[model samples]
Target: MESYFRYDRMMPREYQRRIAENVIAKGNSLVILPTGLGKTAIALLVADKYLREGKRVLFLAPTKPLCEQHRKSFEELMKLEKGDVVLITGELNAEKRRGMWEAGRVIVATPQCVKNDLKKERMRLNFGLVVLDEVHRAVGNYAYTFVAEECRRSGLHLLGLTASPGSSKEKIEKMSELLGVKNIEIREETDEDVRKYVQPIEIRWETVEFPSEMDEIRKLLEQMIEERMEVLRKFEWIKAKNFRSLSKRVLMQVRERIERSSGGVKWMGLSQHAALMNLLHAHELLETQGASTFAEFFGRMEAKEKKSKAVMRILKDGRVKLALEKASQLKVDHPKLEKLRQIIETGKGKMYIVFVQYRDQVKKVVEELNKIPGVRAERFVGKREGVTQEEQKRTIERFRNGEFNVLVASSIGEEGLDIPAVDCVIFYEPIPSEIRNIQRRGRTARTRPGEVIILITKNTRDEAYYWVARSRERKMKRVVRGMQKMLQDRRKGAQSKLTEFV
Candidate 1:
């Protein structure tokens, strides 16, 4: 086993070696190396060299744990006092962050926190170098782009670090342009330099098919579509209202036919309504892109708001109020929870990291797991209404320490968090976004052997998304390896010329 070396403990490994050599050759870089490939080690190695020259450095990770992890690595490498390296997070007070910024040589923080400091004019960026961790997020609305833009505007050099820059060539190039990167350094596990240090990733895909009882429920859903349409109309869905309003006094018969067809289907539980809403949200993502997608989702949310208003409006209408009361009691069965429980009980020995897209779904998983005797489970989420940072840290630490066998988490748990290695990763639902899928699976298959199980509800959007993510992941791996090969080849060509001249 390779020694668990701190930043300054031993000579740099393959990933770090490439980074060190490149930083010495080219002033700024964008390094794309996969997870667990020692990206932080490279950052630390470069920071150590730059700090020795009395240069200040800024390292931006995507989350708090990552910031703390990088800060700890820097402190150990520089052998500095506690005050010399500090982490700036949302949890810290602005005054404390300002003080830390002024005094610290190495400032580690999430991109948003750094952006806020810059926005408030509380922090200065005279640093010689800025390192962007998980640099793939340099896309629209992500704080990484904001921080990188600010660095460029302030005239500071940058080093972008990411496992997969992006799933597509266009996205990868776009991120590169956004970060102002001229040289892209990529490395693959198959490369001579990487092979020595890169652990082999054995990915196994386990597919879950729905039982016949679930299939019957899905068919019944289609049959009752008309009833649901009427329910939505009562809720003042403009789409339903417009269909009713426009067809009135003209083509009344056609409108009636359409309404009769739609109203024929039956709808299920509040839980199912929530599930359907989520499925609709995913469909919106797949069928739309850019600003159009945002507009569509916003439109649906507005419609839902209107529906709720309609419900409140008719509370005084005796007939409508009674109907509304009865509809609210319509319970949709969430059988998946019990299925998940069974999986957990039977797969006890296999370490699992469970992913649910929504926070409420994560809570549901935690609640269900809690009901199972001898099963320990907790949710890992960002600081929100019901969870605290301390709780998140404790949950992570417990899972890492083997005190807990499973971690139920939301999308917040996906990126940049140092979740320990596990044997199995189970997605509560398939995430359509390629970036999210990569980050989720990255928690497992980190080192040693691992498997990913996707629990897809039959006849739902989950089915399509599972394949969509798989295709994207395969494409991304190829792209990462291709970029790495190009860099290595260029390095060899340059070395060959020098040898010939000698």
Candidate 2:
């Protein structure tokens, strides 16, 4: 059946049409493509085909902003009347949502809203196809996981889409199993067919020297971490006292073990764990983030000392007092801030999205960037940080409209949001996760050629994180390709068996 819809603004690229055709032919398909390469375009094309077949389509994204973005695209791309499509989110009253669901031929929704609807038996999987954007999130207890399971049970056609599914084979396979998608379609920037559409993104590591003044702060925090780890080791909570072995993951396991117990020992371990975790965070601020960020963190801890015995104990420690004093007395900014100013001054990019890891740093980065003449920077953060949805939407719009040249955002800007393509993306610090690494880099190089500047603090976790994400991104491609081949072989075998039976 031919789709009643057409790309009225711009014609669909040849590769997008091919991928859409492939997904429609394959029963349930997962499409992995680099960001800005029109993954959503293929999704719309597939939705159109199903719509023309006289079946409804469900477009699922992770956030309300994303859902609204797709809703606009659905209306803009085709000749469908306004009543033919609708946006249903949890923000709407359940009764109104049900009405929209009944009236619209297509629904663009957030997974949480759909999950809630399903949980209350407000709706069934009545659609012919469910388009799962950011499909890699369909794992564990995520709302996406629940919706994917429901789609699987209904045996509806699934068109899963993502830029990065992560580098872990186990997690990817687990998500694949959850979505019940038996086929995979993967594309990379290097692929011959996709190369023409993918604008080249030049990723540069802008290494910055760690400030010498914060050395005492980091050293003191490391000593504190080691002391706590030693006690945990003695309690048999951990196998060894090696500080390197005490990653956040390992500490979380220790926390889990402590929570599962009930005794004086458990109480003691919890105290030690609490202090250790706080100290580790302080150390990270000293290393990866600047002195002002560390001071903000230390000040918060000092304020909490009145209520938390663990915090009180940490504050009373002699070394911690010295570290806090030193951080407060620091006169120089982290070298990365200077480097960032230089990048903006050079005018390499007219617009910039500076990806900061912490909210505290988001404010600091925006402050610093705006100090540069002709630079108008604003902080963009999450709802937990008190940035309402309307505020976030305005911030992105302001940045896009050139009201601000730089957008210093926390992790929230890395996913699902319909942020426009900037000329350059600045990573305030390297992230260890491949999924985020890809997403942050994808913010640039969207339509035209783009630049990615990563700020790496020398000899800190910044360098370590950069390498880890790079290695994992490479590994992800290999893992996805292997999964793709395995699925194709199995599919071919099934086809031959059916042919023989016929």
Candidate 3:
């Protein structure tokens, strides 16, 4: 750990001091620091202090890549042997996981696998501390709750690390309750104490209008919502008590229609299982949206249901079936795709990273980029068939070395992967989650000036998400600043009281 400080000339001393103070506080704490603000360093400091006290620590992340990133950060900061730290993602064998968990003093793992391991009763029973990274995912049914429960039952210290824990007040309280977090340490990117540690982030917003063809389709689709509602009502797919319950069904239908249309009958027939698997994905998206929302997060859920009902009603009338068919056939570009193309072209000699929300969209980006000459692109997504972790690492290394000028990545690259800094990041569409937004942006501006260009489709769910994220990011920054100020004030008050008593 002392040797690592030789490289610490790059980090701000204030950050180290804050982390030291936090570790000594000796209670559960929620830290709010923006991306690229050294949250991993704080975790490392805490891990070292706790481990020195004969306590093992578990660092939890929402994703495997982030777990790996935290493990690397710990190794770099603590100068520990590889055997001293372990990254437990789903990729590991059960036997290997059991072995690593027992041997490692500092273990980093995805919450899901950790929770499953606990369920399987694989316990060394010596872990005295737990660190929850991206702690915002602590919401309903997420494995974070189970991990927290296990830690509490074990009487270990709890620490939560996140940029935005709660988009709303209820969410914040829920996170607190989940982790037994009694104290919170927040650092603002704009705070005087933290400004020296933050790099400048320039965000450029561009809104693209929907293709003209989709406009009439969108209107006609809206008109048919009543009929769709009636069909669902007839089928009992949704309870009459809540209209929003039917939202999932509508999204599923839309997703199916899109896939079938895109793949055609031949592809769909040959890959029926894959087609149905897409339905599973659509279901997950809807479930995540409906997890805690009584209403739709952005009206996409509600609006889709309403549109489906109206579309069904018109179908019964037989007047708009032909129109609907044409609407479905109308090819609509994401609008920002062209802008992304321009960014890639304009930012010559710089690496461009693009983030899209869907797997299908990721494929579309790769296909589009392939059409361009001398522009090789690769997809960095969750570990799937044909892509091993080692291969993924090699691919990223190649991209960093300029073997590929552009990288088309999914949410996987947004988290803790060791992807090199890019000159420009293009968002295929604005996302609803603030955590994703921050992580996506964090991939850039690590060593030099970087730009983030968000491609938003105007007047659609994309625009709505854009504004929602912006508002939430602003609120989060404010909350972080307030918390930092409170900490400073408390420190000042303590010092003043001590002087007066003396």
Candidate 4:
């Protein structure tokens, strides 16, 4: 309701105005605001300052769909001519892109396109400000790092934005360094200034217990993994005190070491490790996910030719064979699925987005939800899953226009996509990554109060994943705070040293 700038088009909230003012004044900033906190609005406000200085502004997103979304949002918010605002993509011919590069006052593009153009010398980096959305991806070999380096060389102001950088201090530091971020401005929903604007999100954890039959399958898989680990231990391949206590990280290291070995030993280790991994995956599918998912996975394995002797041995095991048969005979669905249906029924007229980790689960969820009368559901998956970008856009539009009450999606729905705000977000199963967990919860509680429901199977990997995400998120905040303080101390030291010289 309060307007801070001359551009009356966007009624800036108090927190947005403060954050934008700091970012613009600081010049190079990494804005770590939670999702639904109007991080984009802050970017726009800072960009408007650069534009008012008669300089071009370039906004970069990680994906074409996100780039298009930003372009549309800027168009709707800013009073600019069609030619003044351009959305650049690989689809644009070089000549047209060149012309747009010369004439456009504002450009929204994916980092890869900009990186390509820069590499080919097709376009010069002459922007006044470069805004990188989802900037946590700036680490490692991502195009964002290349593009940000170019922006820095061009003497352009850099603005990095993301909900969660990551759980590791090293990765966050790398992201900051790559983006030339001199200041870190982090805001959470619980922050005093942001609390008033944040809509309440009630979180619910729904837990289900695996049946005795599924427990039998889990025990068989555990025994098989232990047998494989013992073989590795006999070879001095794994030094871990107990195989049962070994984490996935240690298992991965063991697998890597086996990959580098030679001869019959290599084959033996590789095949056994592969079988162990597959069995672990099967255990997850059966315990955390449903019997149908496990049955489907087992069927796929059964249909494929035996690639490894260890896998063949696993298939031949009477316990595994019996477990597969029991999975096939599973008549009832996962309790989580039933719980999801009950949640949807409660929110009959409201919109919902159900986030699953697998494409098959997305399809299965859509199918099951559509079976209920008056519940319209559709599957939203990535382009890799055979759903084109255009179809994804259309699906989101249809969802926005109320054509579907529920959208079942894979990890594609977790980050940077322009998903419509829903009344609730249902996690089909708990995930271990803090970044993804935060992103999924962020799909709701934007403009109105919402709910986040996470389904976990008791005493399985679901519970482990749920706890890991929570602990990692807590650690991430501490790391960010420490980074911010370190930056502040460094700046103070430099200023004090300058004063001593004076």
Which candidate should be chosen as best, given lDDT against the real structure? Answer: 2
TM-score, model 1 to reference:
0.72
Instruction: For each candidate in the order shown, give its overall lDDT on alpha carbons.
Output: 0.66, 0.86, 0.66, 0.85
Please write out the lDDT profile of model 1 over residues 325-410, one tens digit for every residue. 33234343244566678888887767788887765467667877878787888777776756776678788888889887888887
lDDT of 3 by residue, 66-89 (tens): 677787777776756668887788
TM-score, model 2 to reference:
0.96
TM-score of each: 0.72, 0.96, 0.74, 0.92
lDDT of residue 321 for candidate 4:
85
Candidate 2, residues 342-400: lDDT per residue as tens digits? Answer: 99999844988899998888887788777787888898899998778999998888888
lDDT score for residue 501 of model 2: 100
lDDT of 4 by residue, 1-502 (tens): 2322346666878988898898887668999988888888899888888888888899999988999889887887877777788889888887777767777889998888888888888888888999999998887788888999889877889999999988988899888877777788998888999999899999999887777656666677778778877888888778876443456877889888988899999999888788877887877787777778887887787788745676678788888888777777767767888888888877799899999887767888888898888999999988788888999999999999999899998989989888989999999998889999999999999899999999888877788788889999999999999988888898899899999999
User: Can you tell me which runs of candidate 4 are displaced by over 4 Å?
Assistant: 1-6, 93-99, 239-248, 259-264, 302-319
